[model samples]
Target: MTLGNWFALLVALVVAAEVVRALRHRAVRQERWRRFFRLRTTSWGLGILTFLLAVALAAPLLAPFDPNRQLDIVHLTNRPPSSTFLLGTDPLSRDVWSRLVYGTRVSLGIGALGALVAVALGDGLPFAALVVAIGLTSWFGTSRLVRAEVLSLRQRDFVVAARALGAGSSRVIVRHVLPNAAAPIIVSAALGVGNVLLLEAALSFLGIGVPPPDASWGNMIADGMPSIYTAPWSTFFPGLAISLVVMSLNGVADGVRDALDPREAP
Candidate 1:
């Protein structure tokens, strides 16, 4: 019923999922999927992400209190946490912890959801368009490089042998060309998450992101500006949460990239 209990349960579920995945990785015979599981770093990064998401999902129900509600002025205005207010009370006497918790859901939710929506929409026409542009620009930038590499690989004895063995051009391209050419693309895409979150935060901070009735960290800071000196926690807590989530995402993404790319080297 309480926030702590819900958070604990969520953690337990994630741990259980991880254990099951670990067991499956050990027990399953699928070599392809097994390779994925063997990448411990990816799993670790994903676990961090999943926990962040769980906190967001439970925000509405388990926030310390209604973020928008004005608290009783008699108790504590701009009060640091006491027996009554866990994290602290803001200028308006609203609970800083509760707003921060719920705002996590809003800010992260909008950032992530907006990014996914943009990506999803782009995956169709815009993506195809970008693919074309990417194909063109990439060819412009690295066509020479890709060609040199491909030509060198082609001259390799194994490639010659495969060609002599009747492997089609398609097979050669699929097996060789793509594996080498796709890495940059994946890396580029991975870099987009931070930019997307920043954009979302900017939008929210500008007051256009999520309308009121929603608790966004950016918007919270925006709302707190006028009273910030009087009650800095109102600004600090939400801003800190936003910064942490965005930084966490960046860290996780970098970890995954390093984990997956052995060529990055020890």
Candidate 2:
């Protein structure tokens, strides 16, 4: 199988495992969800993320024009928002709204996949070299966090009882240690998504990521730089996108951390 195929399979398996785990702890999961939704910032952040996800998923239907297609250069180039074009046009007469919608897919996909790889494998390959690089480099902190949590959890009474009840090391770790240590892992992964998004944008801005014609927020901002004074929307919109996503992710992460806190558990 190809690298992408393997990655997909891994993600599927991880998601299935999580679903099974949640089902096994349905009441706890429901309570946690309640706590999570109760936070106003969490709801707001999740609302924004849900909207972006919908836009990304429906890009073909939502975007009026092809993100990379340049049209009517003489008349459409650098045009501001209007009835014909919502976010306006770029230097090449490409629709900003279309590019922005498609860019949401690129940004969120990379951020989510990179965070999953970092949290799951701790180190990985080059299916998407940028994703792999970001995941590999960023996992160290998460690994340390997991390790500390695991170390603390290993000595807990439940873990000791599991081992004493003839459970093997693997069983003890999976059934006793990991489920308890999961809170920090989840929180770290949530925060890591924002970090990965920022890193991807920085790399793209430096011309090393998500190559041209692919409307990354970073490169879009770079493209808008020369026209900043005359057509500020070009750079402004992309910068605003980055800021909003990063901030939303941070807020969601904070909410998840609080919601998952043992102290907050009923």
Question: Highest TM-score: which candidate?
Answer: 2
Candidate 2 lDDT tens digits, 23-134: 3355355877766655567656765676676666666766777899998889888999876777889888988988987888778878787335433553233326777787
Please list the C-alpha lDDT of all candidates, in the order they appear.
Answer: 0.60, 0.75
Backbone clash numbers for all candidates listed: 0, 0
TM-score of each: 0.61, 0.78
TM-score of 2: 0.78
Candidate 1 residues lying further than 4 Å off, grouped into runs, are 1-48, 73-76, 114-173, 262-266
